[model samples]
Target: MTSSSKGSYTRLCIQVNLDKPLINTVKVGRLKQKVMYEGISFLCFYCGRLGHK
Candidate 1:
């Protein structure tokens, strides 16, 4: 797969491994917005914000 697709897949895997209630509350659009606005590498489910690691 392409690097972009691979990155998305990895993000999905990380999200799945996190607590259900954390990710369930926020809509996908909000997550995208957080990423866009903050220009971060990933959206953190636990803290509900964009972060880089």
Candidate 2:
């Protein structure tokens, strides 16, 4: 199997219209997973950031 250099097994990226509000969660099968950003140290604004949650 081959993989793209852009994403990981647990990660995905897509181009979206910036005019829309960001979605917090996405449905993965039956479970909902929160959307996350990378490279930040820590934060928790309803959603969590790395090293904080």
Candidate 3:
């Protein structure tokens, strides 16, 4: 497969709605951990940085 296509499959993007109430810190932390455990890269929507859980 081409690099662009491969990159899309490997990366995981999660878009959180800003209109919703803020998620609890503990819950957010757990979510990140869960995503990491799944072996997919997480990208931060706000800062545009990769999340390291």
Candidate 4:
């Protein structure tokens, strides 16, 4: 795992592999910000663009 520093946000990179047909993989990551936001943005490596709850 590795992390890149951004001015306002931090980009996290993780690696994993899948074992089952239905399951893709398992990834653990975190995003830390000074203030709370209304929307959620997750650029998933497997599924791609994930937003909101």
**Candidate 1 stretches greater than 4 Å from native:** 1-41
> Model 4 reaches what TM-score against the true structure?
0.17
lDDT of each: 0.41, 0.58, 0.41, 0.37
Question: Which residue pairs of candidate 1 clash?
Answer: none
TM-score of predicted structure 3: 0.20
lDDT (C-alpha) at residue 48 in model 1 = 53
**Deviation in Å, model 2, residue 12 alpha carbon:** 1.9
**Model 2 misplaced regions, further than 4 Å:** 1-9, 39-53
The superposed Cα distance between candidate 2 and the true structure at residue 18, in angstroms, equals 0.6
- List, residue by residue over 1-53, the lDDT tens digit for candidate 2: 45655454376667654345446788989978787755545544445333464
**Candidate 4 lowest-lDDT run of ten:** 16-25
Residue 48 in candidate 3, Cα distance off native in Å? 18
Clashing pairs in 4: none
What is candidate 4's local distance difference test score? 0.37
lDDT tens readout by residue for model 1, 1-53: 66666333223224333333243433466463222223336756556554533
Of the pair 1 and 4, which is ahead by lDDT? 1
- Displacement of the residue 12 alpha carbon in candidate 4, Å: 1.7
- Reference-based TM-score of each model: 0.22, 0.47, 0.20, 0.17
- Clash pairs of candidate 3? none
